[model samples]
Target: MALRPNPTLRQRRVGTELRRMREQAGLGGNQLARELGIHAAQVTQMETGKSGISVERLRTIAAACLCGNQPLIDALADMVSERGKGWWEKYRGTLSTDFLEIAELEANAHSISTWATTYVPGLQQTEDYAAAMFSRFTPSPPSHDLDARTSFRMQRKEAVRHGKTPYASFIHEAALRMQFGGPRVLADQLNHLVDDSLAGRISVRVVPFDLDTFPGGGENIMFIEGPVPELATLQMDTAMGSMYFDAQPSLTRHRDVFARLNSVALSEPESREFIRSIEYEMRGKYA
Candidate 1:
């Protein structure tokens, strides 16, 4: 079968697991391919998530690799059999693949933690706020493009709100206070935040500007916890795209960073109060 070229995270994940199993068994790609009577390039493609593997083929490879663990085999089989259009497919021609990949990661993440220093995190952004933020870029986006982006964002937010996943975010006070879409929009967004907080699907905290410092102080970051423990932590960078790190030492460092940020952020109740206070200030402008 021809390779899919651009595979979804689900597909890539399955491929990653297969590769890990092969490595664990001390078998090289060429050796595995030779054993399976397939070209080495095909093995490489499957391992890299550029192609899909069938259940029977996967089982054969698993057995040859000595991956007798039934649970692991079952998981691989399940991932291969699982078929559906990813949320990102809709925006394929409109947005970059990198953007779609980020959306997919957010959708599939078991838990997500983000620290926003400049703007409201996309998942938490209100439509008007998103429109205003996008409007500020140089050259200015066309009306249709801006609307499409906004629609895409709203759809993503719904996925998070309705899905079984959990989301937590630390917003810098500056971000919450930014007058995007003017005072009316800002107030509505803050009010929406207040309401969403009450929903229990999301946890919001404010990182005070006075807080001493941290490595991520100036950077916007999103850390997503994946379903599998080994795949758990992903750090997203706008410029660098998504990076997955499973090493204990690296995970420990990022976790510590989050803990420090959490410590400095206003408690959830305090955050709501802070937001309410800001809303009050904006009301005068809108009124």
Candidate 2:
């Protein structure tokens, strides 16, 4: 098969874990190839996700490297296993890579948790709110592109919901107050949020403005849990680009930060009531 020029996040993850395993066992790429009877360059390609690896070869490498973590190995194998194409593939060339990658990540995630200071998380946004968001793009996307993106986002939300992956989120009160698409639109969005929270569709907690300190700045932080701790990923949307973090230290630190946010945020019942209160405020002020 021809090598993939732009491998999906899952494919790259398979290679990343393999590289980590090799390093842990103190074997270089060339050394591992010598032990596995493959060319040195082939080993590098496989490790970097440019080339695919079969399940049998993956197991062989694990055995050769003395990797005793059975669960991690199985997770890696599953990542590489042949599977049906995702619904997002249709939009592969149409939408940007970040959109497809995020959908793929959430579609496969065991669970997802997100934190946002000034905007609602995409998975939880209403259709109108989503469209309004796209309208704010730097140069303002053409109508066709905007429609395509909005449609893709709605499909993504449905896919994750159909998959029934556990979802939870923390939204600062400032985001709840920030008006997007005007007061009526934001009010409708908040109402939808309240309904979802009350219906147990998602666990959303609000970080009130009165807090002494709100860590992690104002950026969006999403933590996608994998089958195992080692596969967990931390993602952030930056001005430069989307940044994905999987290093042990990075994962550990972000996990801790989320824990702190969770603790500081309101409980489920309290959060629901709080969101409802905000919705009522919006309606009273602008309805």
Candidate 3:
């Protein structure tokens, strides 16, 4: 098969796992290709997600390599078995691949845990709030592009809405205080957050500002649990762009960070009350 120029993150991750397997088996790309009776370039293609691999092929490779991690093998086989594009596919050309990758990440997640400092997590933001935040982008996007971005964000909520996926969010008090779309919009958004929390739709934990220390240096971090522990990934937003890490070390570090963050965040009931208090404060001033 010809090389694929732009495989999605998930695809690339598949290749990553395959490469890991080869390395674990103590086989170089050329060596594995020889063992599998294929060209070294094909092995490279599979490892880079430039070419697709079937579940059978995956199992074959695993068997050839004497992989004993059946759980991980099964998990990866199941991933390649997935047949269709998710809702995010429709926005392929209109938005950056990062946006689509995030949606895909959430859609397939067994659970989501995130720390938000500058703004509400995208999965929890109201349409108006999202639009307001996006509107402030430098060299503003065209009005139509703005609408597309906002709609894409709102649609991304399906992954968490209706309790489809378990979501745990650690939001800073400062983010809750920002008036993204003016006080009225923010009040409504706060009300929505409170309602969502109380209704058992998702878990909200507030990280109060009084805390002496902050985690992740106030950067946004999203840790998505995959089908199996081996597949979990950590995503961070930086000045460069969205970056995803699935290496064991990165996942382990973020998992520890989130645990510490959770340790300081308010309990569920406390968080709801805290959110409601802000809602009331915003309402009292601007309602």
Candidate 2 per-residue lDDT over residues 53-126, each given as its tens digit: 99999999998788999999998888889578888999988888988888888988999999988788888888
Reference-based TM-score of each model: 0.85, 0.96, 0.96
lDDT (Cα, tens digit) per residue for candidate 3, span 1-287: 66789988888999999999989989899888888899998999999999999999999999888899999999999988888888888899999988999988988899999899988888889999999988987888999899999999888885569547888889999999999988888999998888778878688899988888787766788999998999999988876779899999888888888889888889989998988898888888865
Question: What is candidate 1's lDDT per residue for 1-287, written digit by digit as tens?
Answer: 78886877667878888888899899999999899998999998998889878899999988998987776677668668877778778899997676687787777687898888777888899999989988987789899989988898889888888898878888888888889899999998999988888888899988766776644646667887764455655565554544555555776777777888777788889999998898889988868
| Candidate 1 wrong stretches, greater than 4 Å | 24-26, 59-74, 215-217, 233-235, 239-252, 285-287
lDDT score, candidate 2, position 188: 91
Clashing pairs for predicted structure model 2, backbone only: none
- Candidate 1 lDDT at 227 equals 49
For each of the candidates, give the backbone clash count: 0, 0, 0
Which residue pairs collide, candidate 1? none
- Quote the lDDT for 156 in model 1: 87
The local lDDT score (0 to 100) that residue 190 gets in candidate 3 is: 91
